[model samples]
Target chain A: MTAEALTTILIAMLGGAIRVSTPFIFVALGETLTEKSGRINLGLEGNLVLGAMVAYAISFHTGSPWLGVLAAGFSGVFLGLMHGSICSLKKVNDIAVGIAMMSFGIGVAFFFGKPYIQPSAPRLESLPLGGWASNPALQQALEINPLFIVGILIAIVMWWALANTRVGLVVRMTGDSEPAARAMGINPIKVRILATAAGGFLAGIGGAFLSLSYPGSWNEGLSSGQGLMAVALVIFARWNPLRCILAALLFGAAGALGPALQSVGISQGYYFFNAAPYILTLFIMVAATGSNSARAAPGELSIAK
Target chain B: MAQAETSFATPPAYDTARIRASIEAVAIPLGALVASAIIFSVFLTLLGKSPLQFFELVWRGGFGSSFSLQNTLQRATPLILTGLAFAIPARIGLVMIGAEGALVIGGFAAAALAIPLVSAEAPVYLTMLLMVLIAMAAGGAWNAIAGWLKHSRGVNETISTLLLTYIAIAIMNFFVEGALRDPASQNKPSTMPIGKDYMVGNIPGTDVHWGLVFGLVLAVALQVLMSRTTFGFAARVTGGNPRAALAQGLPVGTLIVVCSAIAGACAGLAGYFEVAAIHGQANASLVAGYGFTGILVAFLARHNPLMIVPVAIMFGAIEASGGLIQRRMDMPDATALVLQGIIFVVLLASDSLYGRFAIFQPKISTERT
Candidate 1:
């Protein structure tokens, strides 16, 4: 490929990375919180899809993208609550319940989402942060969504709280050792459940972005396992909220390889590029697994350590 | 307060009264099923639909007649394989959710491999063996990734497996839509048909293909592998306590990967049959939710391979009935999913029953009184 084309590909890739990373950022933050509290919600894929549908439907009805995002987050909370409550029941496996909830969530979303497929919904606005650039290509690549900033801020706050706050200590204690947590009179179950619900809420918001922002539309195909991939991303980030943000951006760049290449008239190996995120996840997991840092994962969390 | 005392008094006698405990397990799940139906009815009521009419429609559509039973069996055939896919690995304590991925990749690989054999005058049995092997290999490798990750990295198998599913599906879509698209079908991209003569034949009396038999055979084989073999014992030991298994010198990682590969192979075989027997080509037809439904089936069967057969057929009935409900009640076809989800959650919660049944606990305190 020509140097100009290579440059174009690089710019498009950066742009695509920003767009795709928004949802990952939201979901990774949520999963980090949930994992920190010693519970895992694998059903966020369901939450993402349902949130996408709700965001689209609500935006269509209210003509407000913000409202749609809020409604989507609430819908995610509902799913999270269901998963948390069911898992909290004695003898119920959290992972299994999460899997079941995923199917239930997606099924419900598809069923209810059928009507909104054709209708136009209000979409989120992007800020043209690259207006200062003289090059048109640079300007085109600068359309950043506001939610990206919000996700970053949430990650920073979560990181501070997890390291410093009393609630964070309790959550960490619960994840580190249930016996210690119980001895300290903390209800591990409740903490885990709340964390899961909060995580779901964020995932739901992430889903809403898909429908109400870039590639903006309501459809059954809007999500392709971003929620599920977030779980892997959590382990890659070592369950730290701040690290999750960086991981999300890296995943986004990997995911954008296909479309970004396509923009530069390179269509060969698009499938391989599309498979990049998963491949990256597998390799990162391999690198991190059984290692000192990964071993540092809280003992109670199932993904690592 | 009395951990040692409580632990020392657990032995109990078995009697006819224990049947009540079994009944309660079934009863609670049944109640949950009914409750989901009621809840679904309420949703329908809000949608301005009659709940009574929907049930009648489902009854008539799913099992009220022989034709429906046949349809149910046909649908259940795939579920049986996919359910076994989930159930088999579950026996060894791995939650392998990549069956869906295995199914798609298996179907694609099966169809792709069939391309070369079609023009040659090969023996029919040889051709079938080649197809099954190709399909199983595709699926086995797809699932082995998750297993390898879990055993190697301590990465949770569930999410990695699930992510692999999306990658698998995307690969299938790209291949079918781009490289393998049949020239004649413009709108919907698909592979070339495998032709009628090469297609799998149905059972003599039923419309269901020989895949149903394969599913049953697999279930039985897995039952044996899980119950009567040294491998089964090792796997169980690993599953029950990985640390203990390691202490005992069991090859825990190999067991996990091998079990996952077997599970994926089952799902891949299901995909192969779906292509060769039903769709006759790989397309959007292969993307249906059979793999996800199998997870429910596996869970409902309590992860028992032997139990998967009947439970699969039951779910098959529900799926067959979904169309009837949709046609008669104007409801969406996802009603079966709602019911399945409810049953799954309730059944899982019922796992607490092992110690709770009064019959299972000794009555020494009562005897003293």
Candidate 2:
């Protein structure tokens, strides 16, 4: 390939990385928080689709995209409540609940969001970050969505709070040892419920990005399992909020490879390229799931075993 | 020993412990189903629709007539197979949800294989047999990858299976749109048809295809395999207590892999039937949600192979009625999904109530009392 061709692919990938990674960022971070609290929510995929639908429908009806984002988050919270409550019961497996919640969330979304499919919703606009570049293609590629920045900021804040705040300490303690958390007069169930809800709020925003920003529409096929992929991304990130951003970007780049190659007329193996992230995730999982990664995981995580 | 067992078992008048256990097993899931129906009724009522009509239509569309009953059974064929796909791995204590991917890959493999055999003018029976074998082999291999990873590398089976599912679908799409696309299949890219001679037909005097028969035989075989054989015992031991199984020198890894492969093969057969009996070709049309719904079926059956049949048929009935519900209730097709979701959640939640019910508990044996 020529240098120009290489540059084109890189730029396309970079653009794709940013566009695709925003959802990954929110979802990975949400999963990180939930996992740190010693629970894994695979149903975040459900939250994502529902969130996208709610975001689009709310934006269409209320005329404010941010309110749609808020509505999406609350919608996520509702599912999280269902998951947390069902899982908290004795003998109720959280993993199975995650699966059930995923189906329920998607079902609810599809049921309610059917009518909003055709109508256009007000969308969140990207910040003009690429104006400094002279070429229009480069300029268009550089237009960063505002949620990208907010996601980064949230990651940093989460990192700080996880270390410095009492709530964070409680979460960590509860995750590491339920008995110790109980002895300290903390209700681990309540902590888990709240963490799941808050984590869901983030995942909802991630869903908002899919429908309100890039690919900007409400549809059933809006998500091709991005929510489920985020759960994998969290494991790859080793449950750290800051690392989640980097992991998500890598995934985004992988996701972007197909469209990037397609844009540059290198469509020979587009489908194969689309499979890259999943293959990469499996390999990363194989490599990461040794003694060190296990130590990095919260001691009480049900998914760990 | 068989004769002795039959003779003694026939006259057991007070097997309360055995009787209660069986009753509890059946009663819990039934109660969950009823509860979900009630909740779904409330949902319908809130939307100003009559829940009674919705169910009435379900009965009418799914099982009211012989034709509808056949349709329900026809749909249940795949569900039965996919439910076993979920159930087998679940018996080995792995929650493998990659059956959908296996189905796609299996069907794709069968179609891809058919192209070569058809071009060579292979005999019809031979072509069908090879296609079935190839489909089962492909699916079993696909699911085995996840099982292998889980046992050998300590990667979580659930996540691994889920990832593999995406990869499987991608691979199929890659082939169908490229190497395997039949030029004749315009508007929808698909593999070359297996031709009418190779098409799977329904059972004699019934509209239900031979796939339902396949499902029944497999369910019975698996039920016996799980409850009667040494291999099944090892797998159950591994599921019940991995540490103990390892201590007893049972090959836990092999059991996991074997169970997963068997599960995959079941899903693969479903895919083959889907291609040969229903679609007559492979394409994006093969990407139905049967694999995911099978998870609910297996769970509702408590992962019992025998129980999967009734549960799968029930789900199939609900599924077959989707169009009817949509027309009668003026609801989206997702109404079925809503009911399913509610049923699944309630079923899992009802897990906690199993031991709590005093009546279902085994009667304490007391000579003095």
Candidate 3:
């Protein structure tokens, strides 16, 4: 590739990484919180899709993108609550319920989202970050959404609180050892339910980013499997909130590779490149979990079991 | 609490306990199904649609006549194979959800292979056999990646398999839309058709293809293998307690890999049938959600091979009526998906009911009472 071509690809990938990583950041952070509380919500993909649909519909009706984002979060909370509550029942499998909730979320979204497919909703505004850049392409690429900043702040706060805060200590205690949590007068079920709902709220905001900023629309195929991919992202991030930001950015860059290359006239194997994030995630899972012992996994999580 | 203590104090007879266990197995799932139906009815009523009319349309479109019955059977053919795909891995305690990927890739491979074979004027039967074998091998290898990773690398098979599915679809799209695209198949890109003469024919007296026979035979064969054979016994032992199996020197890794391969092969065969018997070519059409629906079927059947047959058909009927419901009720095609989602949630939730009933409790410790 020529030097100019390389520059274009790099700039495009950087911008794409920012644009795409916003949703991943929210989802990965949310999954990090849930996993830290000893539950895995594999159904987040469902939440992502439903959140996208709900956000779009609410934005259209209320004429406010921010309201749409909040609606999306609440929708996600509802599904997460369902998954968490069902799983809290004795003999119920968390993983299976996650799958079922995923299906439920997607189905309901599709059923209600049919009418919103054609309407345009107000989009989230972006900050002009590259105003000083001479190239129009660079400036366009640097236009960043405010939600991206919010996601970063959340991750930082989560990292700090997980280490220092009392509520964080309780969640960590519940995750690391159920008996220990009980001995400390903590109700593991309530902690898990609340943590999962909070996680869902974050993931819902991620969905809003997809519909209100980037793709800026609602559709059945809006989220291919980003929600599901975030589950793997949490594992790759070692369930650390701060690490989740880096991991999400990495995934975003990987996702952008195909479009970046295509923009630079490298169209060969475009679809193959489109699959880069999934391939990257599979490799990460294999590498991270390759050891016989669950080194990075939460002690009480079913994924470790 | 007093009632439970009293029940524990007086044990039921062995025969009665055995009958009750069987009854609970049937009754619980039945109860879940009824609950789901009632819940779905409420959804319909809220939408100003009639639940009774929806059922009537489903019956008419899926099984009211011979034609619809045959269509249901044809749809069920793929579900049977895919159901077995999930069922097999589930038995080994791995959540392998890549059957859709296996099916698509396997079908694409079969379609790609047919081009060269047909050009060479290969015998029809020989060509068909090659297609089936190639598809099975492709699917088997695809799913084996998950099993191998799970056993050797400690990767979670659920996520690995799910990721592999998307990758598989991308791979298929790369080929079908680029290198393998047939020039004539514009707008909707597809591989070259397998040709009329080489296509698998319908059964003599019915419109259903031989894939149905393949599904039925394989289901029975798998049932026998899982219940009667020494390999099956070893697999059960390994699945029941991996540490004990390892202590007994059973090859746990091999069992996991083999079971996954078998599951993949089953899904691949479904793909082959789709190409050779149904679609006659590989295209975006091959990515139908049969693989995911099969997960529901397998779960509904509790992963029992024998039960998969009936369960597959039941789901097949529901799927076959999707269009009719859409037309009659003026609802989107996704209405069926909503019902399916409800059923899946209810069924999974009902799992908590297991062992909660005293009637189903084993009589082993009851001698003290």
Candidate 4:
């Protein structure tokens, strides 16, 4: 590849990483919180999709993108609450409930989202960070959405809270040892339910980013398993909120590789390139879960067991 | 020896207990189905649509007539295989959710294989047999990757399988859109058709293809194998308690791999049938949500091979009537999907109800007094 081509691909990938990773960042951070509480919400993909639809529809009707984002978050919290409550029942498996919740979310989204597919919605604004750069391409590439910045802030705050805050400590205690948590007068179920709902709220905001900023539309196929991928991203990040930001960006860059290469006139094996994130996730799961590195896992997590 | 044999013989109460347990097993799922139906009726009523009419349309469009029954059976063929794909690995305690990937890759592989055989003027039967074997092998290898990863590397099988599914779709898309694209397939971008002469024929006296027969036979054969054989016994033992199986010197890893491979093969065979009987070529059409639907069917059937038949047909009927419901009720095509989602959630939630009811419980010998 020529130097110009290489520069284009790199710049495009950088921009794509920012654009694509915003959703991943939020979803991963959300998943991180849930996993830290000893639960996994595989249904976040469903939440993401439903959130996208709800955000788009609410934005269209209310004429405010911010309200749409909040609506999406609330929708996600609703689904998450249902999932958490169902899973809290005796003999109920969290993983199975997640799958069922996913179907429920998707089904509801598709049913309600049919009418919103054609309507236009107000989009989230972006901040041009490369205004001083002479190159138009660089400036365009640097036009990052505000949600991406919000996601980063949330990750930082979450990281600090998870370490220093009492509530975070309690969640960590519940996750690390249920008996210890119980001895300390903590109700594991309530903690898990709240954490899952909060996680869902974050994931819903991620969905809003997808529909209101990047893709800027509502459709049935808006999310192609990004919600599901975030689960693996959390594991790759080792359950750390700050690490989740980096991991999401890495996955986003991987996702962007196909479009980036295509932009540079490298269309060969485009589909293969499109699959890079999934391949990366699978490899990461294998490497992270291997016997040597298993100690990084949360003690009470089912995936760890 | 005779005295010991007599003492070990089946007690009279054993039959009653077995019968009672079976009855309860059937009752729980049946109750779940009824509850879902009622819940769905409420949803329909809220929408200003008649629940009774909607159900009437479902029955009329799915199985009320000969034509509808045939359509239901045709759709059920793939469900049965995909249901088996899930049910088999589930027996080994693995949540292998990539059956869709296996199906797509298997169908693509079969279609690719057919091109060479058709060009060489190979006999139709021989070509199809080769296609089936290749598809099964491709799918088996696809899923075996997850099993191997789970056992050897401690990777979670569920995530791995789901990832492999996306990879499988990419692989299929790469080939279909590039190397294997038939020039005449234009907008759809499909592989070359298997040709009229090489297509699998319909079963005698019915419009349904031989795939239905294949599904039925496989379901029965798998049921027998799982319940009446040593391999099945070992698999159950491993599933129930892996540590115990390992302590007993059973090769648990091998069982996991073999079961996954079998599951993949079942899904692959469904793909072959789709190519040979339904679509007559491989394309994006092969990625229909049949593999995912099979998950619901398998779960509803509680992963019983024998029960998969009824569950598959039930789902198949629902799917077959989707278009009719759309036309008659003015609902979107996703109405059926919504119902399916409702059923899945309610059924899983009802799992908690098991053993809670006394009627379903067997009479304890001590409690009988």
Which candidate has the highest lDDT of all? 2
Docking model 1 quality class:
medium
Residue lDDT tens for model 2, A1-305:
78888888888888889999999999899888888888889899999999999999999999999999999989988988888888889998888899999999999999998999999999998998998898777888889999999999999999999989999999999888999999999999999988888888999999999999988999988998989987799888888899999998998899889888888788777889889999998998998877677778898888686
Tens-digit lDDT string for candidate 1 (A42-135)? 8888889999999999999999999999999999999988888888887777888887888788888888887898989879999999999887
**TM-scores of chain B alone in all candidate structures, in the order given:** 0.87, 0.94, 0.93, 0.95
Q: For candidate 4, lDDT tens digit of each residue in A88-142?
A: 8777767777888888888989999999999898888899999999978889989
Residue B154 displacement in candidate 3 (angstroms): 1.3
The best-first sequence of candidates by DockQ reads 2, 4, 3, 1
Predicted candidate 2 versus true structure: per-residue lDDT over B1-369, tens digit per residue: 445444655334257567877888899989999999999999999999999999999999999899889999999999999999999999989999999999999999999999989889999999999999999999999999999998899899889989988998899888888888899988898999988889899899999999999999999999999999999999999999999999999999999999999999999999999999999999988889899999999999999999999989988899888988888778999888889999999999999898888777644422212
TM-score of 4: 0.96
lDDT of 2 at B26: 91
In candidate 1, which residue pairs clash? none
Candidate 4 positional error at A37, Å:
1.2
In model 3 chain B, the worst 10-residue window by lDDT is B360-369
What's the TM-score of each model vs. the native?
A: 0.92, 0.97, 0.95, 0.96
Tell me the lDDT of model 1 at A212.
87
Q: Scored by CA lDDT, what does every candidate get?
A: 0.83, 0.91, 0.89, 0.88
Give the Cα error of residue A290 in candidate 2, in Å. Answer: 1.8
Best by DockQ: 2
Reference-based lDDT, residue B1, model 2: 48
